[model samples]
Target: MASKVTPISGFQEWLPRERIAEQYVLDTIREVFELHGFASVSTRAVEPVERLSDQGEDADKEIYAVSRLAGGDDEARLGLHFDLTVPFARYVLENSGKLTFPFRRYQIQPAWRGERPQRGRYREFIQADVDIIDAAELPGHYEAELLLVIADVFGRLPVGAYQVHVNNRKICEGFYRAIGIEDVIGTLRIVDKLDKIGEDGVASLLLAAGCSQEQADRCLALARIRTSDTSFVQQVRALGVSHPVLEEGLTHLASVMETAAEHAPGVAVADLRIARGLDYYTGTVYETMLERDPGYGSVCSGGRYDALASDGKRTYPGVGISIGVSRLLGLLIGEEGLTASRETPAAVLVAVNDEETRSDSIRIAAALRSRGVPTLVAPKAAKFGKQIQFADRRGIPYVWFPGAGERGGDAVKDIRSGDQVDADAASWTPPAADLHATLVTPGSSD
Candidate 1:
C-alpha cells in the first residue's frame, strides 16, 4: 500500500480554475511592467549560505537550507532564497560589466522561506518584482516614479480600493537620533510592530529597548503621522525634531507625495509607520493595504536600497516594489470566490454524430481552431443530447454540430440560450468575450 499523501503546510496549490485566475493576475502585472520599459530577468533559486547569511537578525531562522542526502563534507553549503532581492543583488554584481547604467528589470518567480504559514503568508509563494538600479547614485525621481507603475498595475487588476503607503527611513532614523535614541535599527524593528502590537504595546517594547518615557512617546507620535499630500512634511516639523537627515527625509518624501498627487491622485499615502522589517531598505519604503481589509497585511511592498549591492570598486543603488501574487489571490479567490468562467479553455465543443462521422467533427474542430477559436472535438460518438450535456457540464458555451444546418453545412448552438445558427467552420467566430475564459468575481456582472 502507498503511504498516505498529505499537503506540506505553507505550500500553496491551486486547482485548474483557480490557477487560471492566478495567471490572469500575473499577465496583467507583466503587461504593466513592460509598458513601463522594464526588461525581464531570472536568477538562480539556490545561493551559497554565506551570501544569504546577512539579510537581518531574524532572517536566518526563516531560511530553508539545502543539502544532498549523500553529499560529502567538501560540498558547499547552500540554501533556498527567501526573497528575490538578495539573488537579484548578487546577479547585478556578477553582471555589472554587461549591464547598462540605470538598468530596469522585472522578475516574477517563486521564493522559499521556512516560516510558519498564516492567512496570506506562505513558505512557498510567488512574487512579481520590478527594480531600477544604477552603478552610482540613482535619481530621486525614480523613487516617486515607481508609485505610478504600481498604481497602473493595480488599476488593471481586480483588486479594489487599494492604497500604497509611502515612508522614508531617514525620517525615522534622523528623528530617533535627534531624540537621543542610539540603536536606530533596533528602534525601527520595534516601531515596525506598531500595527501588530498597537501603540501602547510598541511603546512598552520601546521602553524595554532602553527608551525613556518621553522618547517612546515621541517615537509613537512620529509613527502616527499620516497624510494624503505634501502636508506631511509640515507635520513632521511640527513635532519639534531637528536633524539634517530628518530634513532630507522630509524633502524627499514631500517630493514623492507631490509627484503622486499630480500623476496618480489619491492613490499614495504618506504613512510614517511603514517601516518594512527588512534591513536592506535604506530610504523610501512602501506597504500597500486594501481599503476594505487593512488588517490583511501588505499585499505589495518594497523600497529604495542605496547600497543594495557593492563590489570592492563600485556600488549599485536601486529601488523596487514586489506584488505578493499568492497573498492577493488568497483573499480574492480562496475567500472572496473569484474564479474563471470555465474550467477548460475550450469555447466550443464539436459533437461527434457517430464513430464513422467523427472524422467530420475533427475536421470542423481543426478549421475552427485554425481560425483562433478554442475548439474541442468530442471524445466519444455519443448521442447529440449527451454531447450537448457534456459541453454544458464543463461550462462550454457553444456546441457545434458538423452537418445540422439548413443546408449540408455546420451549425453551432449556444447551450445557454438554445439558439442554433448556421455557421461556416472556415470563417465563423465566437463573440470576442467568449473567445477566452474571463474572471468572475462574486457580485460582479458577466
Candidate 2:
C-alpha cells in the first residue's frame, strides 16, 4: 500500500534549483577552507551517549538516542551528535598518537537535534566547522585568525554586510566576580535569554537568583557594552569594576579587535554581552549576525574550548566556528527567492534530429562532455520545437542541432535569445559564466 506523503516538520528538503544553489554555497566554503590550509575530516554519526552529554551545555534534552530493537543487554547506548565539536574532540583523542600537534581541520556534516524548530532552526541541519587545536596550549592569535577565515568565506558569498561579534568568557566571569556576584555560569545562562525575555525579565530573573538590585543593574550595564574597535576596553574600565581576570580578558579582547581591524576591517565587533552559554568556552567567543536580518539569530557561532578534547594524559585546547548552512539557506533560498540559474548542471542539450540519427546526438554529447561542457542528449527523436521546449523547461541555455547547417555541419542555438550559429563539436565552448549553474540573488539581474 502507498503511504501518504507529508512534509516532516524540522526536516529540510530542497527542490532541484534550490539544491544547486546549496551546492554552490557548500563548494565555495570548502574551496575557501582548503585555500586557508585547513584539512577536511569527517567523523561517524553516533558516539557514546556519555560523550555527547558530557559537555556542560543543555544539549542532553536535544540528543536523539540510537538503539537497535533486537539489541542484546550488553550493547552500548549511543546517540546522534548534536554538534560537530564534540565528535571532533573524540576523534582527536582517539587518533592523537598518529596526528601532529597544532592541527587545523574543517568538518562539514549534518547534525541532529530534537529541539523545537523555528525559522532558521531545524532538527537535522548541516554545519561547516573549522578549528585549530594543539596540545597543552594554543595561542590567542588563532582567535583573531579564525575571524579572518570566516570573513574571507563570507566575502565570496552573497551574504551582505555581516558582523562577527567577539567576546571573552573571562570578561564576563571577572566582571561578575568584581561586582560581588557568585554563580557566574548561572548568571550567564540567564543573561543569554535577554533576547528572548526583555531587560525587565532578565533583571527579575537575576534578582530571583539571589542577586541584589544593584548587582543586577550592573550586569545589565556590562551586557550593553558593544564597540567596533578597541574603545570597548576603556568603556568597560569606566564601569568602576576591577579584577585581575577582568584585566586579562580586556587585554586579550583588545588584541583580537586590533588585529581584526588591520586584517578584517569592519568585520569584527567587541560585544561584551555574548556569553556563548556553553561552559567549555574558557576564552574568546564569537557570534555572527547578518545586518539585513539580525532577528534570524546567529548564522554562525563558536568559541575557544580549553578542555573539550582531552584524555587523562593529554588535553587539546582549540578555537573554532561553525557556519549554519541550512539556516542561512532557509532565509536566502526559501524566503528571499534566491536560486540558481538552472535546475540541472547541463549547459547544452544535444537534440535528437530523428530516430535513425540518435547516435549522432549521443556522439556530439560525448564530444562536448570530453571538452568539459555539461551536455545531455534528448531522450527521443521529437519535433524541433518539442526538443527545444524540453531544454527550455530545464533551463538549459544552449541546444545543439546535428547536421542542421547549410554545409552539413552542426548548429547550436542560444535558446534564450533564439540565435543559432554554425559550430564545431570539437572546438566550440560555452561561455565561462554559462558552463555551470550560477547563483541568482533576489534583486540582481542575471
In the order shown, the candidates' Cα RMSDs to the true structure are: 1.3, 1.2
| TM accuracy, model 2 | 0.98
lDDT of 1 by residue, 1-446 (tens): 89999878887788877887888899999999999999999999999887787877688888889999999899999999988999999999999999998999999999998888989999999999999999889999999999999999999988899999999999999999999999999999999999899999999999899999999999999999999988888888999999999998999999999999999999999999999988889899999999999999999999999876898789999999999998999999989989888888999999998999888988899999998899999899988899999998878999999889999888899998999999999889999999988998999754
Which one wins on lDDT? Answer: 2
lDDT of 2 by residue, 111-211 (tens): 99988998899999999999999999999999989999999999999899999999998999999999998899899889888888979999999999999
Worst 10 residues of 2 by lDDT: 51-60
Candidate 2, residue 128: the lDDT equals 99
Model 1 reaches what TM-score against the true structure?
A: 0.97
Pairs in steric clash, model 1 = none
In angstroms, give how far residue 77 of model 2 lies from its true place: 1.6
